[model samples]
Target: MYTSTPFNIADQLPKGLQALMYRAQGAMDNEASGLQRRSFLKVVSASGFALGAFPLLTQAQAQAATPAAAASALKPTQQPSAFVHIAKDGTVTVTINRLDFGQGVQTGLPMILAEELDADWRLVKSQHGNADPAYADPVMGMHLTGGSSAIKNSYTQYRELGARTRAMLVAAAAAQWGVDASSLRTREGVVIGPGGKRLGYGELAEAAMLQPVPEKVTLKDPKQFRIIGKPTGRLDARAKSSGGQSYGIDTRLPGMLTAVVAHPPVFAGKVKSLDDAAARAVPGVKAVLRVPLDRGGEGVAVVAEGYWAAKQGRDALKVDWDTSTVEKVDSAQQLASYRALAQTSGALKYNADVSPLATAPKKISAEFVFPYLAHAPMEPLNCTVQLSGQGADTKAELWLGTQMPGLDTLAASQVLGVAPQNLKMNVQMAGGGFGRRGIPSSDYVVEACAVAKAARTAGLTAAVRTLWSREDDIKGGYYRPMHVHRAEIGLDAQGKILAWDHVIVGQSIIAGSPFEPFMVKDGVDATMVEGMKEPYDIPMRLSVHHPKLNVPVLWWRSVGSTHTAYVMETLIDEVARSAGQDPVAYRLQRFGDKHPRHRAALQLAVSKSGYGKRTLAAGRAWGVAVHESFNTVVAYVVEASVKGTTPVLHAVTAGVHCNLAINPTSIEAQIQGAALMGLSMCLPGAAITLKEGVVEQSNFGDYQVPRITDMPTVAVFIAPSADAPTGLGEPGLPPLAPAFANAIAKLTGQAPRELPFKLA
Candidate 1:
């Protein structure tokens, strides 16, 4: 069902002002309708004012009886808008509002819309939506693609859009046939009517544009769905597999020069002096100019004919950095400080008296350390910017795979001294983002725009494409914040949680971000404390310390769940073992009846993996963990064996409860990918470190990711549900490490408390 954001008038506003505000809001809703009406009128008027012979359904009946409108109570704040485009050749192009960074939203969203549209699957295609106000997320009111919200937020919206478009087409066809619109039906790309009459949607496109948009339209029921819930192949699989897909890194404009910047070794360090003579002497080098970097630092960008030339010029450049302004962050020192801070309560998140901890039957005090982690998307960061015009008429265009295109456009506009509307962003497909592409500062995009503006000022008059080498991309800041967690737990003989006191010390990701005002409250960053004590409902007291450090930090894939899930799940497993009970049963007991999804998912994994019914090999053991992130629950039952001093995962069975899987194949792929990433976090040398304010690792050689050999056999199972879909991208990640670690703990009799486990 269509759901629109309700307009509420403040008591302070005058009646006249409130009325004006309502009118403005209504205009926004009707914007798409107006466009559709104009197109339809033009077609009908041009066709000698020919009218359809069928009677249209009354607006009231259409609004009340439609399954699509009644299914969802929360509708789009604005009208169903700019996504579907039908070509005369019957090719239907659907524009996705979010970045397609391997999470399968590129195909999943279209499946939702196309299912309701009843369009021919073979004729359907998809494209990335540009940074336009019309494409803003209906709920977020901005361009964003993180937190695995792409499908969850836009599921109903896209479905309504398809239903509306189909209704309009039916109206057009009914008019032409002089039949009742209610008697019309659509199957595949054809409209069917009495006497088996049929017409392709392409033929009715022009006339359909003239029909008034139905405020409500019927949506297909789950039993009737032909697209969603099916194992459909990705729309872009062929292009990507065939090496024909162009990511942000592949963007190239005529006369576009490649740029590589030599940044300060220290975070926010400035260049005291520069020597560019040798750099300029390099052939193909166009210009070398100092530019402002993210975090108020300074860098020199070298523009050249190509990437190789830019790198050569950048490598040839020399600069003396002034590091006096910024604090030199040493990883070891920071860990020491964090450990000390974790001993004391800083800002209270959950305040429950834990005085009973001393008297509990069983007690455990644990300290866990999570090091900084780089996002390290497969494709390195890059942006292409072109500037035109001058002064007030100046226009700027950008090409990049941006997670927050609107934010990037705003940031680029500020950097180039242009209006946001004048700056155009052409969204491109991304190889993979995890969370790197959604930086709050739009660092890489702004840097590219700065280089373009500087090049234009220097009479270069070419589009500048700023690219980051592998080393630069890895060493560049904005890694996940390092954290130290200390927990003191008291448990009863039955393995039930009695009292728990926890303290976390880490850098705040949202402190200086535009989202801080809303995301951070009462001196607590919500992202920092999510997944602390949940599902089991045994929270005692939790406190956090947000230490402002020179090392830049941002949200990783699952944000706080990355660490919290490990802590919670592992600790719960430990408690179960200590109580002489099965871990899965213990979890189920604690879950009681409130967490049916969690119980169902864990039960599915257990039943499928034969956790209690099957015997393990001589050297192997079972591990199980369940977590909910992004409103989705994922449970993993893993088999692992310890070889020498290292732990090796052999197989994994996953039970996912994301509700109504849009594409079962995509969900399976995402789970497998996330599981591997989780395993990557446990491998040695996976940490991102800082020594005296300089990033230690530079590339894959030092900062390791999982290779194909490291992957285990993963089997995914989805719980049965017809409820609204939840996010699948990140939920699969949080449970993997904890489950793997639990198995290792069983083998070694010691629980791992740090990432990149050190069995030695």
Candidate 2:
């Protein structure tokens, strides 16, 4: 049970003890670390604490002599037990363990606690929780937040926490009044007893905390939830609307210098020689230092008084790089080779193939290829670091908008030669992560720390923050692997799918990467598992994952589903047409009532999109597709009209259903945004090539995203569910490409097998 005494660093304690506490709390703004300068305010707002509770819990947990005692003491601190502390004066403080980027987790998360805690929701405060293994998500198993797992993972725990706290508060009031606990119930912000006697939660916080923590917490049924189902105003809405919201880029320190690393054009290349004299001569260029790459990465750094100065100085510095190997690797030819590789047979089998690739009455085969894509988060990649002086004891602090805070802490500690405990990592609001934030084996943070250490002079290492320009970030390493999929399906006499064989050839996103230790299994990456398996019951279905060895691949927005869904959904349409059946009706026959959510999505989209109805507008047709990811199921129906030279999608109807909605408004925004993002990838976001490698496109200008003019009018609907919450962010994305492509096929009278879904 959480005790509600306001935390006070006792003044009578030793000065050193106070300093350590203050440092750990991250409240010492006078001599802030690199992390403080780059992300202090941002982290404070995004996570809602000076620092997270992990360190405080770590300090307390370490005092236990036995593991059992430590476990007992922790007790997982059920949501009601930890969320929303009430003070004597009535200040309601809410604790949020979920990480927030621009996704509004900071706002949505606290709303759940406020709803059940029954505190003055208007005055509730918020804070971020620290990383702890015990607090690790039951599904993902780490004190981290991504994959749209925030609400889904915390939904039940937090609601239970709120209800339990309400129970505790009611019990406390009942005890004071000498009445039965069951006779008292909560309404609004006060506890009301049988005789109408009442007391605010603030008046009973200390006593409530002393109550025994309940082992079994009962959450309120959905029927009684007040704040969850309805759309309430956002918690951070006022702050954001008033422009008081601080993003990572707005973080700054007193003596902080802006730093920018000059990354090698080619992967794994190094600087043979560099002249920084001209850079040193440039105004505002405080210090010009070259830091060696950590591990087997590529780069050097340039520090200056400001961002523009650092970028200018970096551009002026002469660098001769070793790009001998990758310079000759042509992206166009390499992609073609990967396509060829898809046809070959060496691949790790995931699902056994009973398919008729070994001779059948009718066999249809098609090859589909996908292009590389950038995460292109609204906020580009950036980090701030401050390294202390020499020796293994040298401490480094980092402030990065990364998804995996624990991983950042470990990597930064290793690079700085300090124990992980001594290192501080502050996670700021990522402009966006989309799986790009938790990339393994990438030294983006380590390089910044190394540069800070190398810049040390006179017992003072450099306080540097690195910023990757939009251009640099888009062209940067770590991208979604372009893949080639070879699909062969055999149909019986009635055109029912009997044998299905799918071979996927792509760079392993985890193989040989830092995540290899965790994500890889027997050389088969499960990232290829999503759309690779036949959701429908196919008697003979075989899925093979052929890992394209060279090049680095990271999980994109939809990860494997981005590629696999395109193949499966489009092929399903082909088979439906071959059988002379309606696409929606045919798919429905394959699915049963067992998957209520999946069926709901199909039915909702079919009805809303007028699936079998005629299009009044000439030259326009509608097409539909459905896919499931991160436990959430989505179906998309697109209405497209051929514009003579290009296919222009005019409207779309989408249906999604996750278990519970912490914030209906935010979930809607995420679904709507994800749909547009997926649409752009299918049409304008294409990677072209030159004589050597990728060329022309860099940022939004060359590689266009969806514009206001091109955006389709979308109608989104949510299906209700009674199970555990599923992810909402990415599931809405995987179906857009196929939905749009299928529409194009109907209009053009040709099934388009590749992207950039153009008729020409």
Which tens-of-lDDT digit does each residue in 280-395 have in candidate 1?
99999999989999999999999999999999999999899999999999999999999999999988889988988989999999999999999999899999998889789898
How many Å off is the CA of 547 in candidate 2? 4.5
Q: What is the TM-score (0 to 1) of candidate 1?
A: 0.91
lDDT of 2 by residue, 547-586 (tens): 4533456788778888788888888888887777778887
Error of 1 at 495 (Å): 1.5
Whole-model lDDT, model 2: 0.67
Deviation of model 2 at 654, angstroms: 1.0
By summed lDDT, which 10 consecutive residues of candidate 2 come out lowest?
A: 1-10
